[model samples]
Target: MNAPPRIAAPTHAPEAPRLRPDRAEAGALTRLALPIIMARIGLTLMLVADNMIVGHFGAGPLAAFALGLMLVQTSQMLGLGLLMGSAVEMAAAFGRDALDEVGRIWRRALAYALAIGFAGAALSQAAPTIFLALGQEAALAASAGEIAALFGWSLPPVLVYVASIGLLEATGRPYVGVALLIAANLVNLGLGLLLGHGGLGLPALGAFGVTLATLIARITLAGGALAYILLLMPGRQALGRPRWSDHRWADGRRQRRIGYAEGLSLGIESGAFASMTLFAGWAGALQLAAYTISINLNMLMFMVAVGIGGAAAVRVSQARGRGDPAAMARSAATALLLYTGVMLVVGIAFLALPGVFAGFYTGEADLLAVTTPVVAGIGFLSLIDGAQRVVANILRGYGDTWLPTASHLFAYVAVMVPAGYLLALGLALGAGGLILAIALASVLATGLLLARLVQLKNRRS
Candidate 1:
């Protein structure tokens, strides 16, 4: 990967625009964040639909689906993160008005996606063994393994298209993905209802049915995104054209350098969450129930941060390419301010109406009692956690990768996991202990990334 060029600031600081709050800047930030946020929400809904469909079958099937999907998603996260580097690269390239270079990045990303996707497929086939090793019930493991193997095979299309989605986003047509993912969700729901419950004289496929439905939906979205790029987007043919003289082989390593760090960062961060989920099991059934519901909501809200962060990424990449230090500063500041302000509102709502959110998930008084504090506390967690996600993306936009990745590993795997065990198990705080660990990790990560952003700003001048 190339070293990012520093933003050369004028000797006179007063000549540049001040980085402060303004209505026009805030409006621009909202517009940029909204579509990306919509895309994230759509993707979240797709998973929610799968979970909902499987849930109708019974607790056992739901457990299998949950375990199986997590296994698949673990690998997906790695591959997806690796491919994500292309988006940042392409966005910067676009900022420089080098359309052909953007195309080359996308082509290489698709190739990487295929290679990684196949490996994921192989892992899916062995997920049952993993489940057994993790001490899951034999029957549950078997069911989950079957579903994972089949759905896992779809990774090639799923990931290849994800790279495509990134390219489209970098090219400034971000809404296309939003439309396709939402449509895909609808397709998944219809097929899930049919395949899982059985219809038209077909037998019920149970968990496998939902997996199959998800696969088909993925294919449709992937196909749709590709078609839009090739047929409708401007300068489509310039994309994917190889330079015969240049060694395409060597660039793959550069792409890996670019993306692998982000992927590893995500894996470690997610691993911390996974470890807590496991810890919850040790806490007991009631605590586990509370942990799962509250955590899921946390994740959902985190997506909002992701959306805001994604917008920052696009803006920052473009700023880098155009060599606009002031623009870069404004983009980052506006995104941070916007995200924090919105999250504070969400946090306040959670504080005031924690029971209201929990009631939507379950009616059991015990479950509600356990969930309320977690929900209330989540408002603050969301503020930091969401900020951490954005800060990571912002750094990625500046072509800074591994440092942030290391920060996540240190904060999450190093800090959060051990803290959860000590606090939850050692202190007997149960689910509350795990939540506190998450909050600590998020706060640490957010602080470090923000400091890095500041350094980058100072360097620009």
Candidate 2:
């Protein structure tokens, strides 16, 4: 019944030296981003593995898995984004050598994460209604709803892991999360096979079993991460113990505000994409299954940008804490530069071998046929999508919150949703049409966000 504590005033420190994208600074950014990139990819691979596993079972289960996952991921992104303020604040604190404040921020963030996670789990219980309201067939909705509710149980543990990882990442210990994620992935793969396919004297539970495996894996990740930080992490003493003073609601308003803007922005963007899946669903099960594979692949590639964006946020937040606008500019520029080169390579691969990539998800020729063009479309989409992603994080790093949310609203909701409806349904373009709408939205979103970042840097400079 106690209110959360208000934020303590910032402890000022002397401004650090200006940093350039010199070899050392760039090297530092690379070192931080690489593990994060691997970790993000590892997280995505778990979903990819689930799709691959379930896809072999038949298109019905795959479609249901996709439907459930799309819904769960929207909620997940909202929670993840809401919790982002933890990393932003902690990184700034670390930059100022305000070690105790970092601990306080983490504690507040963990509470926020748990609250959002539980809320999401509760909402997920209504999946059948949501899908039915969206106009899906009764049978598909029922199957997908079961999958959604089952997978929903993992949200709490997953967010706990996110809160812990955010603190670790902010404090320059990114590798710990990576190790935990790798272990979790291995466990998921093993359990997925055993439960999903009827090995080890158990009946095949299909999608339900696969989801149960994920739930267990997520709990393992949460527990392992908490254990390390609480008992075994270096400087555990400096992390400090939680106190009632740190729990007052009024004290944590600023952190919660950042989380609010981020959660809404991420929710809007993800919800728009989920709508596209619904549109594909209306086109029939074949188109829906194909769209799922294609979009999942796009997300896999997007993780690279997410990693760089995360690293950029930290570097820029650190620069901000040090009162170094020029360094912030350089860091933002460096992240954009790296993101561009990496996306170019990924785009080329997607375009050159779309079928090869599609083949990884399903061996069915009909599904592959429907999915290939969409995969190729994503190659173009990633270029634009990745830019917006990096710039949005750069804005977050600089403490500009609500504007990015507004931009996503305009671009993804205002632009992408109607375009998806028209292109995919109105024009009968099928799954490929859905992807084209995403590209169109990304083009607009990227332009708007890039302009905003430039405006901020110009004012600061």
Candidate 3:
């Protein structure tokens, strides 16, 4: 019955008519983006430490760990997408200062995350057998099985960590979530180093030990974050004695419709990457190793872009809540620019010294040789990928999840996978062909998503 309160405009008056929209948007984006970029760099450093420790152990463990990470990341993308999509919804609700709705959204998301986590755990437990049945190489299948076993145990705690992160990001306290990640990763880095090798009186558990370290990190983060949210945040009372209620199937239905759409879209997108990995696997173990190296290096760049995209979602959602279409458009454009600039620099560096980046993963000459071109290709792709992700997030922030989901499905599943399979297998282009297909799909997806965002902005205008 009540209209939402207006967000007060900035108090500081400009002497001149306010700066151009591009300038203002850029300023706002920089303010939000810098912290996110720093956080991502820190997280990347932690992963680098983990990989450095693992790489020292031996190639087999490193390869196994890489495969495990790929499997977990692919499976978890659905849950991650669901959390993020719901977070955008909640961010919009929060920007309207709709506290009651925020609570309901959080509860619903936690329920969804839990269910998804359990299912992911179950699937991960069965992954080795599934891959084997898919006619993978015997050695690779056995290693994949071992990795899956580690992932099965790691799933529940990681899910809790991810769910907590969703709630934190939704409430517009991403800094807190970033802090938790920093602390957890620090612990993981130290423990991984000590236990991964036979250092500091700790018995080396090899890849499994590193997996255990990651599990510990996730549990620690989940526990710490829950405490911060419930006890320490400024508006703790909102969460403390707030209304809790029985499950509303209608709300669940609404969320699932949105969440599942986003989830499946992300799954298809990530599944394409996984399929590429399979294709690369067929080329040779060295090629698979190269694929793993190049991908890990690229993730550093991707993570930064994702953090900005997350902020874009939050900013756009908040703007949408206020019925400020212009501000939403400005925010989206600003985020795209910021992410593009950052990715461009990273991409250039990757292209210039692909081998240098791959060297971080292995000392093997053969693996490095195979990975160089893949890394170079991904560097160019990252620019386009970064732009598309921002555009997609902006749409999502405006509560338009389905369109982007459809776009991703069309681009990744329909185009990327089929193209890559034909090039890699039918035409025998090998790893290079797979990477080329990826580059093409990313460009297409980016262009389509950007066009859609422009059309939506025009309609709103």
Candidate 4:
């Protein structure tokens, strides 16, 4: 009886072990990344489709399209960079349980978006002048300028869509943006054909027609994204209604500061590539078309990194909001890991099937000959280019901005530009030389970013 009583001493079960933070972050990052990746890919597809349509029109139109894109895309990146702060700030707010701040941040971002869009539109109107000033052939400059003007008006809608998507992504509603992008692409394709080829009693717009189609599709996308944010998103409840009262100067300043650095960084990088495009142009219309196609394909792959980097940004921002440095480190590491694996597969495919990939964009035998090798160059370029993108975004998440911007300036402007000139012109490497220059710059930028991230981690520790 005594032994039984002793055995009856209270025994409590051990509590379930807590889930590892890194593992939880891995799951969250994956869930967040997949849809964003799809959305990013969808965004790239818009350009791909536009290029293919323009390519079929003729090499001259294709060259003009590429030239127009040099301005349009650089401005687009600048706008996106400025708005990127919305996602970081809102995600941080959500992580720290400051839910109300999320909505306010978005409102401020929207205002900035509209202002930036209008400014970009005005800037785009001068593309022809800019091209001529940059030594582009007069005829080519005029054609490209026309295309640029048509594409320029699309900026407001594009920026609005970007800002809205940022809100949706941070709030765990990324799928909506992906769906909207899908719809936008469909609209673009249908209209692009009708306008581009002049069908259904509609006058063929040529390159301008295709560009106008993009403009219309962008407007549709923006409207849909904004509507969802206002009417359907559950997170909108937390984000609150669009209220003017929410506009506070201090808050807007903080958000804009983030954008300033990122915008400048993106401007530098995009401008550098645009300079390379100019180099290709000097090589001839064929080289320009080849460079354009190769870069677009590489950009498609780069979007994979952007998607993962986006998820990492949210995760790191949230961790920062929670004042947890370790979590931030882990989240970044996880993102890099995912990007590495995905890019590895993509790189291998590019190397193995460069010809097939090149075929999809153009039917010209000469164009394919130039494009295929450049596509293969993308195999190695993707890894370094994508790594830099991910690391830069991670640093942005931590609010460490200007340094990254400086690094980009040095790498792209200082290193890549001259290297591109030397390799493409002096060495007479043409399109392939341009690719090599880009790869070199990307490697430098990636290393700088990684070291910066490591420094931040060590300081935190």
Task: Using TM-score, give the best candidate's number.
Answer: 2
Give me the runs in candidate 1 sitting further than 4 Å from their true place. Answer: 1-19, 55-60, 95-100, 137-140, 231-234, 240-247, 282-289, 317-327, 359-373, 426-430, 458-461
Using TM-score as the yardstick, the better of models 2 and 3 is 2
Tens-place lDDT per residue, model 2, 393-424, is 88988888788889899989999999999998
Candidate 2 yields a Cα-based lDDT of 0.86
Give the TM-score (vs. native) of candidate 2.
0.91
Using all chains and alpha carbons, the TM-scores for the candidates as numbered come to 0.85, 0.91, 0.87, 0.90
The global C-alpha lDDT for each of the candidates, from Candidate 1 onward, is 0.80, 0.86, 0.72, 0.86
Sort the candidates on lDDT, descending order: 2, 4, 1, 3
Q: On residues 219-263, what C-alpha lDDT tens digit does candidate 3 reach at each position?
A: 787788778867787775664343446257776566566667777
Q: What is candidate 4's lDDT per residue for 128-225, written digit by digit as tens?
A: 99999988899999999998887889988999898888887777778889999999999999999899999888999888999999999999999999
Model 3 alpha-carbon drift over 4 Å, by segment? 1-21, 34-49, 96-101, 241-246, 318-326
Please, what's the RMSD in Å of model 1? 6.4
Candidate 3 residue pairs in backbone clash:
none
- Which tens-of-lDDT digit does each residue in 127-212 have in candidate 1? 88977787666776687788888989878888987898889888888888998888898999999889988999988898788889
Determine the C-alpha RMSD for candidate 4 after optimal superposition of all C-alphas: 5.8
